[model samples]
Target: MSPPARARPLSKAAFSPTFSKLKTSIYTDSLRPSAPVSSAHFIRTLSWNAPGTLIATGAADRTLRIWNPEKTNVKNSTELRGHTGGVERVAFHPVNETELASCSSDGMVRFWDVRSKAVVGEVKVGGEPFTLAWTPDGSEIVAGRKDNNLIPISRSTLTTITEHHQPVQTNQCVFTWDGSAIFLTNGDGCVKILRYPSFEHFYTLNAHTSSCYALSISPSGGYLAIGGGDALVSLWDTQEWMCVRTLDKIEGPVKSVDFSFDGSYVVGGSDEDNKLHIAHTETGEYVYTIDTIHPAAYVAWHPCRYVLAYSAEAQGLKIRSTMDVQAPLNPSTLFSVRGLLVVITGGGTSIGLAIASALHQNGASKIYLLGRRIATLEKAVETLKSSSSAPHYVDVLINNAGVIGPRNGIELHESESISQLRGAMLKDWSGWESTMAINTQSVFGVSAAFLPLLEAENIRRHWQGSKVTGYGNARHHSASALEKIGTDADDSRLAHIITVASIASYIRRCAAGLVDNASKGAAAHIGNMLSTLLAEWGIRSNVGRPWNENNIGGLILFLVGNGGTYISGTVQVSDGGRLGVFPSMY
Candidate 1:
């Protein structure tokens, strides 16, 4: 629970002195001042192009300045004006650097063409604007108002199309990868998502114990990083709409966080200590710290470069590179394959639903979910589709139907009458038969019905990778195998078959003199047999061995992602490794 070492504050004199000396020694002969300008009124936000060649800053001076940071005598090349009040935040169009959006205290958000320094359009909300976000397509802009409402503005018409209501003051807001939704953090320690265009409440995430301030989505938008008054940064899985991990005991309230373009490193800024801290996104391990006395307003990781940009009071804008440092590689960058179809059965249980979510956040193109209950399946599907990126990918199917049944038997006990036993038998028979029918048989029916759609995806991957070795053939093999099964193939195209088997499958209970009853052990035998059988077709099957409700989802996630890619043909047993040492005699 110790605070990250990178959260320490830096002295202004010390940082600038070293930076100045380094600058003087490296380019002393070429260094020159570009006609000393007036003191900056109030610096708000800073941004850089993907290449780190150009820099942009929004200031209270009512001017947006674009600069060439590479030159020693860097000078402002263009000054943008349109905002009537102090520009509080600025974000560059991800794909087009020539365009950018600025939010001001005037309750107006203006989109500008940086190259022309012309105001393309403006969106007026009701209150002071605190934050602005652009969709992945750059087609829409989301503005966060002081009253905690989020307004989605169309980039074309510059008019508000949707507004999200927050019960508390909204500190920040941003869109998911595909830009179909907006994630907003309130000062009341809550984060919620709203579907774009429709403005429907998607999911409400409660993680922090204090006010939530800043929020940043990983490059893939699979994980969300939140900083708040609690002085901690928590990572949440977008799929399950729940908190996965929390990095605690920081020096101060985090004001901002930026994930590396590759999704490996996370850099955060603290308001209390006025310092910048870096950590590994996956493990939450502290990396390093940059000392700065003045509170940092914003931080950004260059999309394709090693440089990181931040605004410091003493230093107008500072750039640092991890190129020379041996930093841990980013896990988010490892698997960049987009548009893969993943199907999940048993989506009603916490674990099954969690796996589907983790896959979606990690960049899976489509998710096919199966379960028996219509209500649960509908809720899960709605949660996934609410994300902006969800529409681009398809939800092939979510079967929320299941049944369980007895192989054969009718027994009477001394404590119950024949009629009572009959009633119990009827209920158990109905439940068991229904469970197996939906959990096992229905899965086959749905997969069979969706085989053609899955095969079509395979062909697309084949065509996309025709020039690459092994890719086209791999896709073809997958497609042909999936098609041949025609939904009846119980053991094919099972990229990840997550079974929520009960611990009772392994534990032996001798209560009521029912000693050594081997029938209850059938589930374990069936799971093992199915796993071994499925391995032949490249499908991996693993069971979620959760000992408690809390760990159910995590165990399922471990088996589905890269961590479980090599783990096939075996029951995962998610009892946190305790099951390994426990003695099981049956």
Candidate 2:
């Protein structure tokens, strides 16, 4: 493998990448590619244009499709149909931008006006032209014949410039990044490099024992990624032509390979089971695998953007936007609550019970239910323990259990007399103390009982997450501060007190009585304030546990997942849009 001639060393500081459509390699399922943009068919080849404005694909359907990926939904695609047989390859002119050329088993090289979908030029190459490419300068077109010659023709004249003889069973031909050399892949497991214009052989490399299929040069001319019938994508250093790394573990022959625009990532596609692999170029570590995309026959990275376009066994073209936001979906996925030790204060009934069940069903490590009724709590525990997969343990605490006040404490009685109205207000007065006690004052007792456990867990996860994310050694950097303060801050488990509050907390509402609304609202604010007060202890607080039946549990699960750590002082609404409709309590 040759070291890079023009490639710069990777930056020492990690790059914080912004999401650029799905092509940048983000780790969230929220932005995955939808179903294929086109219907099902055998797509032969796909290529993105120079400016990243369009994608061209040739299909076994004997037709060509031009896609405009800028449209988010990609609804406006133009079809060009002049080929009488299966199209083999499509190339957008590197310099001309507006023109594209395609070759087909139909025995012709046709030039196209990308906008009008009209053929501006055509040349009949003898026999079927299987592969085609444009010179980096866009001065000529080169088509590899099914026979033994590479035909280079002038772009302006559409006349043959020269025919370079290649060994029989040649698969494809490509130019180096600087257009300084031409690389040829022969089916006999070798790559031959030759100088341009003079066509003098520079070197012959034994690349693969099996038939070679794809070849791509890094934009920096520093590396080459090649794959063939050998079911591997080998990374070769361009400077020495020595094989630097081999990305194996693929099931079938690799059909295509491409480097990201900046040469940071290598993308490969396998015809076997149609899996696509994205690997970090420097580390040579496989970063992502998108499986079952169908057999991708061709892969092309967008020239100016972080998008990838490919043609599989479908209606021809699939364009994927890549981003750098890659989060693994395992036990530690972004919105997952798996393996969490949880405690719900009101776990025996109502919304509290629902929260408990949501956590139980989704793989919480252990759960401790807290409620005034011991019998009910026991029953709930048995019910939960019966189906849970992970061992149950008492871990975190939630301040979710609460009560409501009289529905009409602040409303006028329908009774005609003033005496009737007086009774309505006075009847609920004695119960008001209990309402406030259970609804707004229970946090002190519940948190006191479980605060230690929560803190312990926080400390454990701090080290655990830190170690897993490559920050283990850095923890010692803060050891001095911890020793000087003589506090548990460094080893504290981020146990949080999660409070469930209704939307009424932020709005002026008396549906459940002014006092009830006021108490609940105070509870919500207290949860947020707790964070600031407990900042030194590493104990955080957040208000708002969404009910699962209402996608609030989904939000609450998110709050408890990895996302929960970053948030501590906000009121996240999980009300199914009911805040706007203002539904009445029955």
Candidate 3:
């Protein structure tokens, strides 16, 4: 190469003439590689020690790797291999950095000593182990298997203590703070609470309609974080075993969820986009999104560090530092009630209009006013439209509307009496048929037609904000935080359903003179039953107070407001103290 042709060196005084350019190049080459490769290897499952200095990861390649990120060596430091199949979950002993537990698809859970790379013990679960959790005291390990059951194993003996029948593919499980109970979710979309050692079924929460894929419990065990295949993450009250709220509106199934050590932030992994969403625990508002291409199968937060680790199919494992992102703005308050189309079977009565109007004033965004007179419906619609700011939200239908029947006594009407009274009763029954057509049949028909709209509104409200809690001029907060979290309009953002059955339905045999007694007894029974059912869905149902009771409207308003959130399924006997005097108590 002609001795590399002596290089020209016309540099300034600052160039350091004593150092040759070729000599500098050789020095740089010696210090740095031309194409440097990453020293970090792919990870699958990750767990950090209490001090966060030691990290453990289970790999898809059937090996347990212990790493000290602080060390520069590529060596795993320790490799454990008792599992023949891929290891899916790993949990470190709370007090021992040298020991950890791992679950694999081979239907086995293994305890490993990291320092010695030895299998300490193992337990055989009947099905593939999908999720594993260590008790707060580290005395036991709870593993959720492919079969919808949770197997609890003693940490020392590696023996099964108890198993729960969950009915769906068990995806995740967590123990309560005191270690008295365990909560588990399965692919069947059900969450169950069981007493720890006895495994007695305490409560079964049927909130989600799809697979519940991930779960996290608050450090205090007051709330549970659940993410499902339905693209919704729900916050459940551990005490009440009811769903308190849902987080982000995701397009994909949620795979894993974890709460920040402080319980202020909730992080979850989604299957749809392989992205992680961080939300505020109090408000369920999105805080930030982690962009990653790998499909994250699981995620766990380091109890002592800012780092979060996730597992991916092709990438194997990855860890990233969570960035602080601004929280979303406080959600808006827009109340909406679904299932508003009610059909009136009997002739048009002022009571029907009053019920519809009351519902409208109580935040029913849509109402189908039904009756027999076209003119009456047109006029009612016009009146409702003019009186309410949300008039366009109302609809009206004319059905067989008329009076109840002739003023004749029941005996006369039932007898073949050829008189005006009999003719009038016949006319009344005709109107009643029309009422049924409009009230009952039309009610069902209208509900079916508007179901999609109702579902859309429900999803919309869920995304808009936390459940509204308070009465008129009352400040709103999450329902659980409120002093009273009822199904009432002023307290909850959940859609409501109101069924206006006649006070006559409760009047036990009206043929006798004891009409008042029969009616009172009937009303009380209906109210109690309805109240119970509505509570199940977080809705409140109030029957009309006794025929002529004062404060009926007030009671209705209250039940549909902040005071009624917890009142459900039971009938609110609108009848006065008369029903209370009955021997039967609901």
Candidate 4:
């Protein structure tokens, strides 16, 4: 017999990435308020429907969410709930647009009709089914469990046809594009190839040092990518099952891996926070790194496009695009607060009201006024809402309420005796207690109360929560391609708090009394302190004093907008050149 020909080498230029820059324009869907925002539902797996118009996600919260990527509002997503345990993996049928399947720790592989949002059929494979895949012809399904069993079921019968017991626990499994072979990764760091239907093992390749966790095959059926606990992705040429390249540099075990639609690049989801590593297929060089706030657990590329969908542990699903179609830097994005929800104390009048008006005009999603007077707060909301269209959610909190304590203004000769002066100040000494409580104490109280809401906002934006310390490792990525992206999707800013203190806090000369100055001063200090205290929670705090009521509003608008991301735990003074005129401390 004639000798078989050897496979040709892969061309590096042919498999190079199409785009180097990427952006995240789509926001993740929000969970219902009934789920405590403090405890997030971690999304472990996801899949794209055949047509690529819809996405299916399985979360630890035991619920499924179907999302339309074109929609701008996250609230437009639809949710399905039925699983009793954490969902592990989800896969859409290869040929059916409306059919989807998922496996869960609940011990069942359920098939759903996405059109009706109902489970049409289920196979109780038992054990904790951790991963699932549909056959290329859509005639069968296979599920792998933690108990080292692989069960195959006939699609028509909806029952397990047989079970294959493995020597080691299987972490992931997939059918080859031709449906002639099955590739499964096991706990002993090996990728086993099995012949279809006959259940005979065909080949075994040593793939990783630690347990193998993730597996993916390219669209062209020419390459296979295997991710393992060693934090590396091994790329193999399918023709001869030869290891062509190894992608390293990930910081943790690769939990999920996927190939781009064109098979030019591969992405790895690591167990470490903020690590979504993408590398080139031909050269095996690092191409991009997506900074997620939580450990990235699952990743899937769109069937027809370069768009990528991924899940952050307990944070939910996010969609990012690698197409360079984002807009450039503009004034509207820098100064606008288009989607921020704001809470302003004493928002009914003067400086507080002006700040509210600026936020309203600039595009704040909602303005919440906090005050004892119902009529005044209602009037402020009506005025703000009357002129604009926005939603209700809190992203920024403003502390702007205060009382002038005991107006004890007296001249040197105004009082004849020391007793007269002392009595004048002591007459209304009772007001001091109330002033301190309302002004200084309330700053901390209100900020503490709104913490969950603030952290929730950060989560909604897909930003990792609570790391107020110095930039740490994140600072090294500041100059990365993420900042060069032209879209708003690159925003990783935290939730903000704006505390309105007075010039009295700094100036030795008091506009009112020592008590008023002391309270405002204390409030200012609390604002600064809260920045450090709450940095761990992903909340930012800033103090603003209104030198010119007009300027204070604009300053606050800037603070809440995209431009103010770096101005946390600091003071924003809007004196309108008053500091230059006065001999007071700044």
TM-score of each prediction: 0.50, 0.50, 0.46, 0.52
Which stretches of model 3 miss by more than 4 angstroms?
1-44, 69-73, 162-165, 322-586
Candidate 1 vs. true structure, TM-score: 0.50
Cα RMSD, each candidate: 21.4, 18.1, 22.3, 21.5
lDDT (tens digit, per residue) of candidate 1 on 1-586: 1111121111222223322322210111112334433445445677665345567787776767776655523343666877788878888775566677888888888888878889888777868887888776677777888876878888878789977776788888788765578788887788878887676788888868898889888754567999988888899877787787877746788778787654556777765666777666656666556665666656777664345677665345666643322333335433332345666667645766765676666666666566657888888888777232332222233332332344223343432587875653454444554445544555456545554444344233221112111110111121112223232111112244445555445655322222112323444455556556544333445555566645654554455443343565566565554445555532
- The deviation in Å at residue 374 for candidate 3 is 87
lDDT of each: 0.58, 0.66, 0.54, 0.75
lDDT over C-alpha atoms for residue 159 of model 2: 86
Candidate whose TM-score is highest: 4
lDDT sort, best first: 4, 2, 1, 3
Please report how far candidate 1 places residue 53 from its true position, in Å.
Answer: 4.1
For model 4, the stretches where C-alpha displacement exceeds 4 angstroms are 1-22, 26-40, 72-74, 322-586
**Model 1 lDDT, residue 35, Cα:** 42
Pull out the clashing pairs in model 4.
42-314, 293-464, 466-536
* Worst 10-residue lDDT window, candidate 1: 1-10
Q: Give lDDT tens digits, candidate 2, residues 10-114.
A: 221222232211442211111235554433246667777666667777766676877777553434677788998788888888756668899988888999997
TM-score of 4: 0.52
**What is the Cα-based lDDT of residue 488 in candidate 2?**
25
RMSD of model 4 against the true structure: 21.5
